[model samples]
Target: MKKLLFGAAPLSSRAADVTWLLFRLHLGLSIAIGAGWSKLVNLTTATEAEKMVGGAGSPPDWFVQQVADLGFTLPSAYFWAVLAVWGEFAGGLLVALGLGTRLAAFQLAVQFLVIAFFWYDKPEPLLGMYYQQLLFWAFVLVTGVGGGRYSADYWIWKRATARLNPPAARAATLPAIPVAG
Candidate 1:
């Protein structure tokens, strides 16, 4: 389980690792703050607004209706709506922190792909689909490459391994010195 969580594939160079870091940061922040935060805030705040105007705050009614229109029907629609909203907000945060990079990236990739193919409509759907497709591919890249060396997963893995074999255990395995007779 630990290995599954922390065993990120090694990068060939420091530059590559840095690039992954930057990409993860931007992608995570964009989803978390730009897309999900307002909806999340509205859900939590329980505002009396009829619909989410200008993308500021989305009341339950509006969000549920949108999810239902997307083919999820009522009751189940509410569950799926909340799931997608949390997936964007919290999953983005986890990706940004590099705590669970692969899992979070995969989730985001699935969510974005769905949005790209299903969410947009006949009016200029091409543009919206193109934009979402880019995000989907970016997330797929992260899922393949993982969090890299500078990620939280690496730091935690390093600490855990160090604890498993302390200095005393290492010294015990060292070769003994021979004294001249």
Candidate 2:
């Protein structure tokens, strides 16, 4: 069983690498534009947002109130919203490009935590937010594992290390030349 699970196998091909890259790109862009970007734009003019859930007539009736309950003060509400939105927007782009992916993922994970906590008062549809939470956890895992073989970071690190140590590259390329009599 162990051998079946951990047996030596050939690495994936370049095509597979490109496919994975495209998958990450699609995932990142969709999450950024569809989910994060709207939040960012809304944060710019969120005073009107207080009307969506309820007006200032009641304290615990609006979305902003929930945010306040989560420890965001009056002015800090805007700041926290902006931070959360930008973290998702910019971090999604970084994850898409596979640049600083781990850091980006970490930021996004924190944003998810904040959003989840703030929304504790009025929970959305389970199918809607559940997948987002799952995605955040996946991002956290990838943050620890890095962007893998399909990432720009991998290639950049390889090139940088190679440039810093030319002898290592040469040694890596050296072949076992057969001696002839």
Q: Which candidate is the best by lDDT?
A: 1
Supply the global lDDT for candidate 2: 0.62
Candidate 1: tens digits of C-alpha lDDT, residues 1-181:
7866775654899998888888889899889866677576664443635434444433356777888988876989988888888888888887888888888889999998888877756524456578788998989988887788888988887788889999999999999999999
Cα deviation of 153 in candidate 2 (Å)?
Answer: 0.9
User: Tens-digit lDDT track for model 2 on 79-172?
Assistant: 6655665666778887888777777777877777556534566656455478667776767765665655677677676666567779877888
lDDT score for residue 30 of model 2: 70
**What is the C-alpha local distance difference test score of each model?**
0.80, 0.62
Cα RMSD of predicted structure 2? 9.1
Can you tell me which runs of candidate 2 are displaced by over 4 Å?
Answer: 1-16, 43-66, 122-128, 167-169, 172-181
lDDT minimum window of 10 residues, candidate 2 = 2-11
Instruction: Please report how far candidate 1 places residue 14 from its true position, in Å.
Output: 2.2
Q: Would you list the clashing residue pairs of candidate 1?
A: none
User: Against the true structure, what is every candidate's RMSD?
Assistant: 5.2, 9.1
